[model samples]
Target: METIQAIYDFLQTRTWLQVNDPEEQIVFLAAGEYNENYLITVEEIYGTARHVFRINHGSQLGLANQIEYEFAVLRALARSGVTPRPYYCEPDPGFDELGNGVLLMEYLPGRPLDYAKDWREAASIFAAVHAQPVDDRLIPQPDPVRDIARECEGLIGRYPDHPMTEARDRLLRYRERVLETADEFQTLTADDKPVMANTEVNSHNFLIDDETGRGWLVDWEKCVVTSRFQDLGHFLVPTTTLWKTDFEFGREGRRDFVAAYLELCRAKAGSGMDLETALRCTEIMERTILLRAISWCYMAHYEYTQDGRALRNEDTFARIEQYLDRMAWFFESKT
Candidate 1:
């Protein structure tokens, strides 16, 4: 209740709002990897409004000015209309008992994306975001292939107690392949232009409104300056699409999704990329993303196995197990 009281007191500072009862007005929303979200409902000058009070525990980008960086990106993408609008940001709110940083933003209305039905809608959201100007403040990942290799090495290295099972060896082999074809991967993205991209584009990261039919990608903790394909690939890869949902598409469906994104980008003012180039980029990006995802599953599986995670979801564990047990499918899809 201490956190609730602090939030109530904080809401009072928003001179433009009317919070009759903080306990009734503020509600716990969700706890993410780095922050706790509180849905704040207050009567604004015009009418009732909803905003998210995000308490940041840390930054995935490892920025000292994490809140500032995130808010900057939010503000930059506001014009794109696919992301939430930022109202205020306090990197240090002096919340010795609550959080390291705070962000107040417009609360969007929607539910976690349903991959089975909302694939094209999800593509539209990414297309709108990818159309936005790239923020120079973001850390650019120019070399995703090498980046995935290094990340795999770090995550897989920590599992010393784990045996070198076939799955582990295969994961390592993927890393070796990425490193070996490093030059080709570089060439694939050499002509690419940087865009505002969310590296984490899994199903849950996106929201689709049933009535209004609007789509949004709400989580930006992993946002970066990178090739648009990084996000598109993440969204399309089986590792992601099948993570939160069991939806899978053969080559035809994958082609159609990219085609939808291409058309949307063209509508957004004639994108510099065409269907063929985007398809090629998406293909290569998925290959490296597979390596990255398996490595992550290994790290997470070990953590969950050791009860290192503060919160564990049976669904997540089940999905990770499926990925490891049926590793052949993930590898075969790389081709």
Candidate 2:
């Protein structure tokens, strides 16, 4: 109740909008791994006009910076009519007891995309994002291969005596081999151009409106200027199945998605990337994706176990082992 009042009072000072009944109107929407999200539907006092508020709660470390970056990207993409319009960004709203950052943006209407039914459309949305010219000052370009290796090394260094010490060491060696293999294809992608990539391309981040059959890409916190294949490979990987249940594309379906994206790229002109180059880049990027997922799984386990003192639940341990097995299989396949 107090939080609602704080939000209402904060909004009142900025605009003429009024929340007559904050308790009934402001509602909890959903929660993500890092933030608590809320929605408030506001109605005009004299007319039937209504507006929705998307309140993103960021209370974690380094989140304040992420919110700023997300706002910048959202503002840029909003001009293209495919992202939500960011209205206000409070990096540290001191009024909140927890001192969490708040991002006030227009609430978009849609549900999580069904990948199996909307693969083509999803690929098209990604192509559209890639088509836009990027301002390098706003979004930093990432070295896909090097960045993943550095992150994995950091995660492994955090836990030196975990029960799976041997597995972790082996994974590190495998990461090196993968990096070597990726270098072989470096020449193929040497001339690749950078584009805006939503490094996190989970199906849930893509909101699809059933009526219009159009999709809006949300969650730009991880947005970066990188190889288009970084985004494309993330979309086509089987790991997406973890978040998107309907994501069960076989080799042919995967090929179809690449075809759709490449056609769009060619149509845009001056993209300077051809079908063969795109496929090779995608193959290299996919390996980096696996390395990234491996790091995330290990980090999650470390965090859950409180630096290795606590015991993790069976299901949680099983999932972690499964990811480890997948990483090992990838390494063996390369050899």
Candidate 3:
């Protein structure tokens, strides 16, 4: 109650009034990795309106340059053809003295996208974002290949624990295969189709409206400038049976999805990439995901609880090893 009072006091200091009406009071929305978000209708001395604010109170990343990040997001969205409109950003000055920073912006209303139905639209959104000429200041200058390699190394470093003991060597074996494949990946030719690399184009990141069937691509945290195929691989690989979901696409179905995307890209750009090359790209992405999953399996065992229950440490590693083998098979099958 004291903390809530303090927040109210802070808002009062800002000359904002908390409307007591059900539609006007702040309502807790979704909780993210670091921040607790709120959807509130605030009234000022002169005007009233609804706004969304994310309070990063318990974030390990803290709110360092968060307002700047939101500004970056706003810039990125305005530049990109397929993104949301960011209305405002609350700066974080004394957040460290209090807690994590708070970022307030306009709330967008829409339904979340269905990955299976909207895969092409999602890919097209990334394609358009990547196609946009990026401001070097907003772009994080990092070597994509090197960045991915470092991520792989971090995953490999987590091995040899109790859960991964039996599977450590196996995972390493797959890593070696991917290393060999990486050299070949360089030889594969792709049109210099621009793709926004920074965005994580996973299923949950997109929102769609049921009425108009328009999809909104959100979450620009990992937006990057990279090859179009990389984005395609990331978008396509997961739609396959790689992850367990109520929605599943069979081998042929997945292949067709990739094919359709290629056609869409070619139709727009005049030269789409070949299937074999796309498969190779998928291999590279699948390898990266495999390594991350391997790390996650170990972390889940040693650190976190799953579904409010302690996960079996050994079982997690076993699943990772099994998935590693599955990926290796996927690679060899492609070959």
lDDT of 1 by residue, 34-56 (tens): 67888889776788889898887
Model 3: weakest 10-residue lDDT segment is: 304-313
The pairs that clash in candidate 2 are none
lDDT string for model 3 (150-264, tens) is: 5555655643354645455665665665566555555564334444464356565676767776666765544555555556555555423344344544577557766776776
- What's the C-alpha lDDT at position 128 in model 3? 62
| Decoy 2 TM-score against native | 0.84
Model 1 misplaced stretches (Cα beyond 4 Å): 10-18, 159-167, 306-314
Residues 204-305 of candidate 2 have per-residue lDDT tens digits of 788899998888888776777777788887787665555446445676776788888888777776456666667767767777776766766776676666
The clash numbers for all candidates, in the given order, read 0, 0, 8
Compute the lDDT of residue 306 as modeled in candidate 3. Answer: 39
- Of candidates 3 and 1, the better by lDDT: 1
lDDT of 2 at 312: 41
For each candidate, what TM-score against the reference? 0.89, 0.84, 0.71
Clashing pairs in 1: none
TM-score of 1: 0.89
Best by TM-score: 1
TM-score (C-alpha) between model 3 and the true structure = 0.71
